[model samples]
Target: MKEKFALGTALLVASTVPVFGQQYRAGSSDTMDQNNQQDTQRGSCCTSCCDECCPPKDPCAKCAQLWPSCGPDWIITPGAGPCTADGCDFFVTAEFLYWAVRQDHLGFAVTLPEPETTSVGEISHPDWRMELGFKVGIGWLTCIDGWDLYLNYTWLRPRTKNETASSKEGFFLQDYFLFGFFGPPGDFTLDNETAKWKLDFNVLDLEWGRNFYISKCLHLRPHFGLKGTWQEQKYDITANATQPRGSTQFFDTITGSADLKNDYWGIGPRAGLDTAWHFSRCFSVVGEFAITALWGRFDSRAKATQTLFDGSVTPAEETTTTIGTGSFKTEFHSVKPVMEFFLGFRWEDWWCCDEYYTGFDIGWEVQWWGGQNQFAFLPTETRWGDLGFHGLTVRARFQF
Candidate 1:
């Protein structure tokens, strides 16, 4: 009887052990599914983009900010004065410009005839002084699929004055040399020369663009626009010759004056890219590049006059195929290409319930206008020289 009882108890215990093990395993599976569901819910909370940006292996706590497309940087937004996070509607910008002009063709005087000295044949370049200018702009952050509109005006008027004295045996550079040929000066030896150059720059730009993120830390703004420009340049020089290279006799004084002007008005298409890499919530490094193709009219004229001590005058003026093909003066209708570049660092922030915005930045900018230096057309064959400007720009912006 005892042996039968022991066998029955062992069978019952074995059956109960297997049943308990099945139940525990089923509970463990259900618990694991619940935990997985919770983790998935937590990780899917990031709303910055459409695709699932969170990694499966990462902790749920970091899922919100660990977007795969974005690095540790924030997107730069161009919203109004107080509202920028979601989308901006309007903003205004103003910039202070301290710039200098670089023109390649304005050579007024040359020193003595030494092959070793750098100044022997080199044309004297005037001091490129920095002048103040201003730019004002208004933009609309449409928030319509992140599109924006901008209109702005820029103005600058800068001038440079220079004076040069030549050695007793050196002649002043003939005011305007002929294309492919630099001929002799009117006088044998030049004593002194004075020159003044002035420029008037006016521009209006209208752009349509959209800003978006390419990566977590980088953003790009691609833009297309119309650029209109009306600019004028004037260069005038006066030279005096008082000595002869051969004879020591008191030479008859010869004076020369040249008036040169180049003016243009054009309207064209402009395209550009603006980029920013944000390292912090409110600070970024930025760059911009642009190109313009202009279809417009250019008017260039130069007149040279020589006065002798004997009350005689000699005047120099001529027409070229490029200048007077269809017109009465030295003017033409053509296309000009211009390029611009900028790089800088900026700080921007928003407060007051994300309803206002303010920003500040400083940058270096350059603009190249191909074949824009038309100051010498007549008295010399139609030759072209490139013109450019480079300098510092400080900008302040606000949104409302």
Candidate 2:
């Protein structure tokens, strides 16, 4: 008998389930059914019929009549219940239904595009000479996310310091102009003074290679490329007494400059590694270390023109005249190894995030060469100077 009773209860609950939901009656201006019939009889004309005079037919009445538990428990009379389905179990809720169809459905279909890698290189050297200068590089990336095929150029002008000379005649200044030709005939006249030493270096590199991701946080790049470099240095020096009041002498002078000129074309393989750590969606720290082995010959030239008043001028000679032209050229084979490093922060997808990136780096570079210190017609010890530098870099890029 107990089992039979339980079975009957289950059947009743199941049968009344459909009536437990929201209902609408045709042409009945009422929102819900009221217990009083007086309102229903008084006004079938408008929706404001009072409950006491014109109670409308119950929308849930048919099922409620079969299963009485569904009438007041699950159905609402508009003003008496909350706007949502709350006090039920195993049935869908109003809040759940609205969210499943609206918010959740839209967010899942929108995704950010894949990130693009570029073929540009940007680098810097701090102590380029003496003035605290910098260098910049950029290029283009080819097929594959991190691979690049590039042409790059860099510039640097280091700081200068004053240099002293023993005699004005010893103050040697080149007579080369913009066209690499001799300047006006004139001896470098330094009234036994000191002048600033100037230093400059520049390069252009054409490289092709791929940057491989060793892990999510690390990248390694091994490249083969060609490089061309140009370098210039200047300095002054003083020599101890040894003269006929005025004598032509050859003594080493430190102009504060290392080498006067150098130019070379090199071909070799380059390798590098970069590391990155992403802490969040919008911030990351990155660093890189690169090396290039370049072998090439540098053809260089230096000239100093001296203008001496014409001593054999006629008695009371007219306007004065100058004479004599001197110059020298040199060529040598050299191999240079270059090293570079950087540390910076990367901002993600700033302009639509995945379309481009910006970075600021502080780093340094060192170049070591294997070659002769001097050559024919070239100063015996003018081929090397400070080969290390450090600086900062700021860059912007677009990914394809």
Quantify all predictions' global Cα lDDT against the true fold. Answer: 0.68, 0.38
TM-score of 2: 0.44
Tens-digit per-residue lDDT, 1-400, candidate 1? 9999999999999989989999999999998798666544433222222233334432212111222232222433421122353334589999999998877867766564533344545466555688899999999877465678899899999888575645544333433332112234444456677777888999999999877666545678899999999999888777765544254443455566667788999999999999877665466798999999999888887766565553222322211112111112377888999899999998876554344668898999999988887764454356578888899999998876
Task: List TM-scores for all candidates, in order.
Answer: 0.70, 0.44
Candidate 1 lDDT trough over 10 residues, lowest sum: 318-327
- Please give the range of 10 consecutive residues that has the lowest summed lDDT in model 2: 95-104
Superposed Cα deviation of residue 194, candidate 1 (Å): 2.2
The digit string of per-residue lDDT tens for model 2 on 1-400 reads: 9999999999999987766542334224253344234433333221221222323335443212111112333433211110112111111111000000000000001111123133332221111132333334445543243355656666655544443333323122221121122232223322232333344556776666554433323334456576667665432221121112134332211111112334455666666665545443234466776677767676665553332332223435423322333456677676667776667775433222112323333333334433412322234434342255444455444332
**Root-mean-square deviation of Cα positions for candidate 2 versus the true structure, in angstroms:** 25.4
- Which ranges of candidate 2 are over 4 A from the true structure? 1-141, 159-161, 165-200, 232-267, 302-327, 350-353, 362-386
